[model samples]
Target chain A: MTLYFMTFILFCIGMYALVVKKNLVKKIIGLVIIENAVNLFLILVGFRFDAEAPILEEGMGKMVAFVDPLPQAMILTSIVIGLGVVALLVAIAIRIYEKYGTFDISQIRELRG
Target chain B: MIELHIILFFMILAALIAVEMRGLLNSVIALGAVGMGLVLQFLLLRAPDLAIVQLVVEILILILLIRATVKLDRPSESTLKENWAYVLCLLLFAGVFLWFGYRALEGLPLFGAPEMNVSDYYISNAMEQTGAANIVTSILLDFRAYDTLGEVTVLFTSIVGAIAVLRKIGRKQ
Candidate 1:
């Protein structure tokens, strides 16, 4: 229960950064933070006390305890997706910097508008 | 549980530093620390596959962000003071979200005892059905192969978009 709340708070911190920060790179950092927070929460949902990794050993008994594998699989895909999004975002940021000559979104806003 | 608690605390702290720090370079390094803490948390939580992927992805992201920061960042660039009105509005929204989110979270199964109606089937029969020792791999590559394909498409599309966006010239214009 507490852990879940902590995860929520972590997400809120990310939201805070995304909303409050004026720097483009800071906003991207916030975005990644939010992603990591959600990923942690998903894996946390599947965690089991005293459970081993989900891999099956050659002679392991059927009754052996293993953590849930579903969220792990989902997180694998999410991690890769996150990499792509971050790459694209940074690329965009670089271009913005090249055009506006600043990483501050406020300056870019005033310049463009 | 205690170990998870410590790592979670570490992650939150690092994330806070990453967001609130003044130096862009320092903030990026703090974000890297946050990712490392996440990798540790994943391993502690028995998600070896995620840990490995996360570690690799974190390295790539750090390299990319550092390159952007070093080459493009100007020392004169400083964060502007955010409008207090906007900050207050955002706080109000976040408060409402947390109140409702807490209620929604109350109905979920407890932390360590998830409702595994679907995963139960996957765990038991995945090995024999897919001939894979790792249930996660089996599920990723077998039961949900279509999802994997979509994921690949997304990756490819994003990479292509990034490459196109970063190109020096577009259509000779």
Candidate 2:
């Protein structure tokens, strides 16, 4: 319960940064924070107390309990997807910097065309 | 349990610093700290696979962000009063949003007591069917191979898009 509450707070902080910050890099940072918080929430859902990792070991009984593997598998894909997103976002930010000569959103508000 | 709480608290503190810090490079480093704390939490949660992937991905992200920040000669600055107003509005919105989220979260299974009906089947039969020791690997590579394929496609597309955006010129003109 407490863990979920803390995760929620983490997510809210990210939202605050994303909405309130004017710098493009800061906004990217907020996106990263939000993604990580959601991933943590997924893992928290799959977690079980006193469970072993989901690996089959020789001589281990079939009934031995293991932490859920479904979310872990899904999160593996998600982590890679996050990398791709961050890379593209950073590239776009750099392009914006090149054209406008600034990373501040306020200064870059005008459209050239 | 206590350690988990400590790390979560530390992560939140680092995120605040990352968002509020004046120096761009410092803020990026603080974000890296949050990633490291997340890696630690993954380890503590019995997910070594996630911990490893997160560590590697985090290193790449930090490097990219640091490079981007270091290349800029001037610092970013914004007006203080406007930022404060935004923060106050955000706080009011967050308070309401969090109350609703709390109610939604109440219906979920408690921490460390997840219902694993589906995964139980995977754990018991995955080894014999897939001949793989790691259930996660088998599920990802065997049962969910199509999803993995889609994920790879997404990565490839994004990388190509990034390259396209970073080119010296977008058009022949």
Taken over the whole model, the C-alpha lDDT of each candidate is 0.90, 0.90
Label model 2 with its docking quality class.
medium
Q: State the displacement of the C-alpha of residue B52, model 2, in Å, after optimal TM-score superposition.
A: 0.4
Candidate 1 C-alpha error for residue B162, in Å: 0.4
10 residues in a row with least lDDT, candidate 1 chain A: A1-10
Clashing pairs for model 1 are none
Candidate 2: regions farther than 4 A off:
A110-113, B76-85, B169-173
* Candidate 1: true contacts recovered, fraction: 0.80
Tens digit of per-residue lDDT, candidate 1, span A41-79: 999999998889999988899898889899899889999
Model number 1 iRMSD: 0.9
- Candidate 2 versus the native: TM-score? 0.95
Interface DockQ of each model = 0.84, 0.80
